[model samples]
Target: MGNSQRNDGVQLQDERLRGEQLRDEQLQDEQIRLRRPAGIRSLQLGDVKVTYVPDGAIRLTPRGWLPATTDDVWAEHAAYLDETGHLVASVGGLLVEHGDRALLIDAGVGPLSVPAEPGNAVGAIEGGALLASLAEIGRDPGSIEAVAFTHLHMDHLGWAHHPAPGTDGPAFTSADYLISEPEWTHRHLAEEHGTSEEMLAALEPRVRTVNDGDEIFPGVRVMLTPGHTAGHAAYVITGGGRRLIAFGDAMHSPVQIGHPEWWATVDHDTEQSTSFRRGLVEEMSRPDTIGYGMHFADVVFGRAVRGAAGEGARWEPVDA
Candidate 1:
């Protein structure tokens, strides 16, 4: 072949290699984006519908968050951690709707986001999409009858206190804010744990204390499961033939289902929290029962199932 012909063939090969390299890089970027926490998901409980509306997510330092865990434990279970070497915990609210009335459980972390820092176990927190997510589901903010809280944490109350993105007032300004009676009576406990006075004031006007077993909404009842906080409560929604327990912060990540004793350092009473977690895991493992782990990234909604004899127990993500 002529020298010019040979040179032309070589140039074409180089161009093809560059194109392939670009495509590979693009694919890698997409995968990483998927791994990052964000988005909305829903699952139906018989006739009632439960949706996990996204606000944002946070990274929890594995060892720092769960003091009991060591390098070896994390190494053995690395899939729960993300690219940033932290456990990906989503921050959002669970919507329970029956008929035209709707109830929002936990308002979600608001729009503000932060980078990981030293000393603190939580990393890179941000929120502010709860309202939009609600809208996406064809529900109006004012249409919600109430906002029942699992606890009084800043992340959960972010949208509850802050004004909607475009307005000067909170999105659910008109809805009654239901708090477990114990949580409200001792709101001071949450105050010391990062909850600001400003947030408390924002919620004070609309707060309506509810008791355990109270029927907060149709087919929904409150079950007091304290420990993560002074009076954290989980909601059980039963409709059709199935039930879904929106166990807010009782267990942050699905990994907790396997090792309930590994409580987060932020938990008010680790002993009590562990006890509640064990019972909760068993309760959710039963047939026709599902769990809503709000902080479980990607799988905001899932089921706690009894593992095989060798595998112990684990969580299975139920599409929502």
Candidate 2:
């Protein structure tokens, strides 16, 4: 065959190979997307609207995630579990909308999933769809005025610090990153909890430290509820004659809603977690108030209600 013909054949083969590679990549992406959770399924309280944008979900051993819970509790709450028989922790963050501006309570574990780690002390998780869900809610990463991190943890700050491929930079480049003063001060200590010093360093430029009681934004106030971490803070957003408390990691599971004494194994201070949880349950039970348990698994957005017979409180999911 002529040299030109052979050259043309080679070029065609290369193009075909590239096309196949792109198709394979797209297929893999579709599988990941299908595995992710759906749109903003949540509620609104006055001017502020909260959506539980799913990044993904994690499956945890009953014994590891909620050490205090018995098999009976799991059996009772079986409706909340996925088919795998593990407790499905709906992995995502919260989008708090106020007028034209938006604020993210926490960044979900980014586009990465790890297998179950039985040997690890805390347990295992798999997630990474928060960005797409944010887009679904009509809020782009750049549109967020600030990303308020409750604590510096790998799962919570993954997307906040890292930009997805082909993105301009960190998602909220123009937005100020708000973190508690104590949280920022001892951010170094977060390394032990799976956060990297390098990531904290990357966040340093845009990071703005706020006092415990500082009203970070309109109708949004910071309330220091430390225990899970040395500087954990919950953002209380009040508007439209109602209040929503973004209780970040104060409690990991809904079972804690009923049994406030059962603290997560990952809690830095178990006693303090229980103490804060008790008061949280009480505060959440008050009229015209709702608690945003960032990691409460299926029952993420709920109002704590006290039983008429004084049987403590239970959660009622807020439907958006």
Scored by lDDT, model 1 comes in at 0.85
**lDDT (CA) for every model shown?**
0.85, 0.76
Worst 10 residues of 1 by lDDT: 27-36
Q: Model 2 Cα displacement at 79 (Å)?
A: 4.4
Model 2, 170-287: lDDT tens digits are: 7776678899998888887799877887788778888999878898767789999888898999999887777889888887666577779877777888888889999999888887
Candidate 2 lDDT at 29 equals 49
Using Cα atoms with residue i matched to residue i, what is each candidate's TM-score against the true structure?
A: 0.87, 0.82
Per-model clash counts, in order, read 4, 2
| Superposed model 2: Cα runs more than 4 Å off | 1-39, 71-80, 121-124, 308-310
Q: Candidate 1, TM-score vs. the true structure? A: 0.87
Question: Runs in model 1 with CA error above 4 Å?
Answer: 1-35
Write candidate 1's Cα lDDT for 24-75 as tens digits: 9865653453356746787776668888888888888989999999999988
Worst 10 residues of 2 by lDDT: 30-39
